[model samples]
Target chain A: AQSVAQPEDQVNVAEGNPLTVKCTYSVSGNPYLFWYVQYPNRGLQFLLKYITGDNLVKGSYGFEAEFNKSQTSFHLKKPSALVSDSALYFCAVNYGGSYIPTFGRGTSLIVHP
Target chain B: DTAVSQTPKYLVTQMGNDKSIKCEQNLGHDTMYWYKQDSKKFLKIMFSYNNKELIINETVPNRFSPKSPDKAHLNLHINSLELGDSAVYFCASSQAQTRNEQFFGPGTRLTVL
Candidate 1:
């Protein structure tokens, strides 16, 4: 079984400051990791995914995440946070042979201006 | 054009009631999935269908059933709903062969009273 964990329940950052949201996963084989963002009352929107190669992956809306194999971690990061970036963020994982992905309890991000 | 769409953005029903949420995707993806986000913001995968065939069914109770009559549409039906069933249901789709970044619909918020 594949599972994901977001250690932080909430992350608060100020606009123009760097922000980070932590995530980790466990899977049988190679892991497919993903990050998604959800605004109020909306569905999840894909941010970025780590399939293979390149530990650092860039995604929509100036978001990026680094996949660390040794630590089994994939952390979302942004160089500068914006008030618009405040939302609920989720981490998900899918193993090599599994078609279904597992998601983490989302972390609420608050970017105050 | 909307990539993925779900109908009945909000649904409120009493216990034991039956209801269905309709989903459609114009992205021409082959894999579609259903997910539930509880009040605590924990998201879990419930079902996945590829090419109108059931591919992934999680430990969800039999009261929840998913139907995919065509590639572009997937619908979820819930029977004898319980208070625990109150959550946000999301429909998402991804191309199985290529980039697997799943696109999600707005989601249906089901409130079981």
Candidate 2:
């Protein structure tokens, strides 16, 4: 079985400061990791994905994630946070020959002004 | 234009009642999925269809049935709604069953009283 985990239920960062939301995964085969963002009353939007790529992956809205194989982690990061960037973040993991992906319990990101 | 869209953005119904949520994608994707996001923000995949064929079916109850009339549409029908079923239901799609990033519809928030 494959699974993803967002250790933090919530993350708070001041505006203009860097923000990081941690994610880790467990899979039997090669992992295809993805990050998504969801605002209140909205569906999730794709942020980025790591599928046999460089360690660092850039995504929408000035966000990026580092895929660390040794740590089995894919942490979402933003160089500078904005109040408008506050939303719920989700990490999902899928493996080869699998049609289903397992999503982590979301992490609420609060960018305080 | 929205790449993916769902009908009935909000639904409030009594327990034991039946309801249906509709989803459509204009992205010309070949796969569609249904996911349930609980209040605690835990996301679980319920069903998946590829080109109108059922491909993935999770351990969901028999009361819940997903129908994909075509490659562009997937609708979920619940026979008996329960309070535990109250959650945000999301519909998503990917280019194929491969490791492509998914596009999600603006979720339908279902509340069973």
Candidate 3:
């Protein structure tokens, strides 16, 4: 069985500061990881995914995630934060063979202006 | 156009009642999935269908059923609804071969009283 873990329930950052939302996964073989963001009462929007290429994956809204095979982590990062960037973020993982993707408990990002 | 869509953005019903949420995807994807997001923002996959065939069925209660009439449509039906079933249900679709990125529909919020 595949699983994902998000250690933080919420992450706070100030505007113009860097932010990181942590995520880790346990899966057999290689994994396909994804990040999604959801605003209040809205559906999730895809941010980015790591399949098999470079460890650094860039995504929408200037967001990026670093895939660390050794750490079993895919942490979403942004060089700078904005109040509008505050939202619920989810990390998902799926082994290459399965059609099902397991999502982590979301991390609420709160950016103070 | 909405790549994925769900009907009845919000549903409020009494316990023991039966309700259904309909989902559709216009992305021409081969796979569709149903996920439940609890108050804590933990997401769990309930069911998945590929080409109208059940592919992934999680350990969900027997009262919760999913039907996929075609490749583009997947509906969730809950019988004898309970308070514990109150949550947001999301429908998503992705191409089966790659299955890297999934497009999500605005979730259906089910509130059982």
Candidate 4:
């Protein structure tokens, strides 16, 4: 069984500052990792994914995530934060041949302008 | 065009009433999924269907049943609605062999009183 853990319940950052949301996972085989964002009263939107190759993956709205295989972590990052960037973030993981991805409990990001 | 969409963005009903949420995807993806987001913003996968075939079925209650009429549509029906069932339900789709980044709908907020 695969599992995802987002240790933080909330993260606070100021506009123009770099932001990071931590995520870790446990899987039996090669893991497929992904990040998603959800605005208030909205569904999640895909941010980025790490299937193979480069450890660093860039995604929509200048968001990116780094897949650290040894650490079993995939952390989301952004060069600069904006007030509009505040939202709920989720981390999910799936292993080989598994159609189901286990999701984290989510971390709420608050970007103060 | 919306890549994924769900009907009845908000549902308010009393306990014991049955309801259903419908989802559709226009991205021609081969897989669809249903997820429940609880009050704490935790996302739990309820079911997944690939090519209209049942693929992933989580430990969801028996009252919750998912049906896929086709590869593009997946509907969730909840019987014996309970207050514990009140949560935001999301529908997502992805192509299995592709990058597998899920596209999500706006979500349906179900409220049982």
Tens digits of per-residue lDDT for model 2 on B1-113? 99999999999999999999999999999899999988887788898888646755547998999888888999999998999999999999997755898999999999999
Which stretches of candidate 3 lie above 4 Å from their native place?
Answer: none
| Residue B71 shift from truth in candidate 2, angstroms | 0.7
Off by over 4 Å in 1: B52-58, B97-99
Clashing pairs in 3: none
In model 3 chain A, which range of ten residues has the least summed lDDT?
A95-104
How would you encode candidate 1's per-residue C-alpha lDDT over B3-93 as one tens digit per residue?
A: 9999999999999999999999998899998998888888878988896457656479999998988899999999999999999999999
lDDT of 2: 0.91
Residue A13 of model 4 has an lDDT of 100
Note the Cα lDDT for every prediction shown.
Answer: 0.91, 0.91, 0.92, 0.91
- Candidate 4 ranges with C-alpha deviation above 4 Å: B56-58
TM per candidate, chain B? 0.93, 0.94, 0.93, 0.93
lDDT of 2 by residue, A24-113 (tens): 999989999999999998889999999985999999999999999999999999999999999999999999868888889999999999
Error of 3 at A30 (Å): 0.8
User: How far is each candidate from the true structure, as Cα RMSD in Å?
Assistant: 1.6, 1.4, 1.3, 1.4
TM-score of model number 2, chain B: 0.94
DockQ of each: 0.62, 0.80, 0.70, 0.70
Model 1's A-chain: what TM-score? 0.98
Ten contiguous residues with the weakest lDDT in model 2 chain A = A95-104
TM-score of chain A of 4: 0.98
Write down the RMSD of candidate 4 (Cα, Å).
Answer: 1.4
Docking class of 4: medium
